[model samples]
Target: MNKNTFLGITGLISCFFFSGIALLQAQSKSADLKNWPKGSSPKEIGTRVADHFVVTPHTNFGKPTPPKVITYPESCTWYGALTFAKASGNKKLTRDLAERFEPLFGVESKMIPVPDHVDYCVFGAVPLELYLQTNDKKYLDLGISIAEKQWGPPEGPRVKEESHEFYKQGYTWQTRLWIDDMYMITALQAQAFRATGNQKYIDRAAKEMVFYLDQLQKPNGLFYHAPDVPFYWGRGDGWMAAGMTELLSSMPKNNPNRERIMKGYTDMMASLLKYQGKNGMWNQLIDDPEAWAETSATGMFTFAMITGVKKGWLDKEIYGKAARNGWLGLVSYINENSEVTEVCEGTNKKNDRQYYLDRKRNTGDLHGQAPILWCATALLR
Candidate 1:
């Protein structure tokens, strides 16, 4: 109990505390430096992605089965390739892909028709961006023309009964808003608005997106695949994942809807993280554990989570691990051909668990590929 002994002990404890703080700070700095690449840039990673898109005629067109001309999933591939081309500053790749769509626009098939205005909305944005980068008015004109079709009063005659059904559904009507619409159209519309300085496109995109958000969100922050359905589909969530990222990237930082959308995104991520399979993928039916772990949804979630963390929209320490896990799971499914397999094809069920489970795999559809490319691109960043 001497004063000298007490002072010596206090000095030793203070040194230990300061040293511990210094050690922790040093570790954090090392971790940050470790994540930083020494040579590669986002643009370089983008070029690698573009190089992966070496499509053969057979791969792109698929084997013909009688009257049905089964084609590779074109939309997702187009988007992924276009994204890579834009990122890498590859004008020829961008132009070639942009021109290839002319045939799609001229075709009349139900599966991949020219007048499928919804898809035109999704794929057109890349062409528009390409035009912006290259000063090619042709791409810009085509993109704007196709985009305008999605807006304004009905321009063309109704081809199918479902078309009218979608119109009547009013956002949940057969074609109103669904999980896929976010990815397929709304993001492109937002980009179109930004590129063209047209408030109409932005307003339309926001209104439709908000309507979809309002209709699909559950009390717990999870969204159903479709408004009329009780099910939450994997690619459906993927659509929202990519859609939100794309939309957020294009939206002005000060826009009023930005905060609401970000909250929705964060809430969705929070709900999603709890359900990630030990294997790192989400199930075909997200809320159901019995369903198989799926790649498309997991890739989209990975991309969204990582992008959110890097942009400071989400806590990197918490969501970053989840994102990394999902990315690893997704990468496990990639084949040597660079084709993404086991993507659940499009589903329409609102109540059937078996339908979700029984969906075919390894088809390498655009639905799967787009999200995978997106996840890879984000990870590379």
Candidate 2:
């Protein structure tokens, strides 16, 4: 062959070889994507969550609470499921789960009727969001009715009585507002306001949030789980952390309370950092290291801190390491099936370290999974 022809043939062969290698690498990456770090993408993490925990039929709807048997944990589960459904494109699960709550509205009497609690807020709020997403007026109406009944007038009590064991002796007479209440209902209220053009929902949300802030903030910038409580609970903090992100996400950019909410979030995060475990997890009792490292709260905190960074409310350089560590620690506890272990079970906690450490860890529950999803979503973003 001539010299020019020989050179041209060699270049073509090299190009073809390189292209083949690139194609192989691309296929390998796609096949191994699931093995990527847990924080890779919201869709992936969400898919893992759905695949592992969503095995049972209507696991989201637990035994109902008062006038109705349906409880808030179920609602929270459904919320997570709904988010997972949307993220994973599982339209059928989304539709089925959303419809299950319709019967909750049919209960003739209020079964566990303490309106100002986090349960009321979360239960009412998730359905409201689902309603908005589906444009289903039923969910919206049900959410509104529950909010109106449970959220007492700004000047009064949302619940008729603060008879719950946690509030039986607290000095406050008004409906007890916990940090989790913000997570439970604020976004729903915002949705209600937007859907109906009614200012009452927004006003009510702001009023209750202010009540929570006024009553729960400690001098150190961390908030106590409840007004009468002294110690900061990690999961409670998580609830508030997630709540702040969701509420702010839905809030109007120019809303007067926007800056205040952001400041509150910043302060909370700063205080939380002081207590973060060396392993990146927060102890059950956030302020105390003697307490055991808890995964659910850590997951929620990770979500909140990362989200705060994304929103420009927090410095990612300073907080990113902490969030990453928390996620790593959290991952150690996630089983192959996506079941999260070492999550503290439900507790109406007081400001006591012993109480936090003593709480049992439950697997495969929404409390753990929701925060895990939040953490994954935050990290992915």
Candidate 3:
């Protein structure tokens, strides 16, 4: 070979060699464990939660009503349990979660959600995750279809001009600035990115997040229920926190939105640290000391903090202490039945503060349970 050809081949080999080394190093780092406090250790908690998920039948937000369609809460919980199973090397769990989902393509096919809304579209993440673990083409097709539908032609009642306008702007027809949509939209697309190694999925998610951040996030780094609603609802903020975490986890390093999204994420974390109750929980009304401590938001924020610290985005010593306390504080709310308590019931935007403060506090709510599982999954990763 000529000298030029030899140098080019050598350069290619060097690139592959370094890339492999980096990959191994990442795997090794993930494999290493930190000594965790009891009940807060990811391995213990993730496995326990994963096992619980396998036994739990699909329910509509943990209510008694027959849930004809799968919901975002169940989808998120399923995805988290699946990841926990994969991370911990639990083959039995991997099988159990996968088997649990297989029916969606068969007997329970009718139960699959229609991707008309953000909540419905997030369900795609679960099948995408299953595809990652099992290499099932059926799962891939189902998930990609759902994810694509989010950005596809706006369907359903054509009453709203906003849907058409949003679609015209190259956004999901379902685009609404609701804090919950951040997680709903991000989960599906981020998982698609992971499953296919596609930059478009992550790019779309990051762009959507930046829009939400610009439109909804406040000077205090928390989000109101809507642009008009002034209250800082805990779980709503949790959705934004978790959404940002998911998007950031998958976004490419050179993504144009990376800096802005990172800034928004870090700013929110700082505010969360300041507002965290002395017991390591965030209040139902995040900024309201009078509001009761809510487990769901605490769990979501804990997950985000743990992820940030793990990824070296935050000060380890400072955020680590806070994250540990958040987990333990969160776990304290779990009853013997394994249900989470003090979860605010499903909420809607209201201008009145008492409406939020007086909202029913639910026991054994999936809103609460899902976030705890997310925290456990973050710890494991």
Candidate 3: Cα lDDT at 123: 89
Q: Give a tens-digit lDDT track for model 1, residues 1-381.
A: 799999999999999999977854443333131143422233443454455653423133333442232232455566666666655557787767656654544562333434345644565666676666666777677767756666533445543555665455443122455677777666567767766887666655665677667778777677787666778887787778777887776677777677777777888888997898766689888988788878778878887887888788888777877776666566667666666678787566567678788987755555676676565556555
lDDT of 3: 0.85
How does residue 16 of candidate 1 score in lDDT?
100
TM-score of 1: 0.76
Model 1 residue runs over 4 Å out of place are 1-49, 58-73, 88-113, 157-175
lDDT of each structure? 0.65, 0.66, 0.85
Off by over 4 Å in 3: 1-33
| Local accuracy of candidate 3 as per-residue lDDT tens digits, 99-218 | 898788789999999889998888899889889988989999999998888888887863267988888877788988899999999999999999999888888888888989999889
Candidate number of the best TM-score: 3
Model 2 has an lDDT value of 0.66
Poorest stretch of ten by lDDT in candidate 2: 27-36
Q: Which regions in candidate 2 have their CA more than 4 angstroms from the true location?
A: 1-41, 57-68, 87-93, 99-118, 152-174, 194-199, 379-381
Q: In model 2, what lDDT does residue 50 have? A: 55
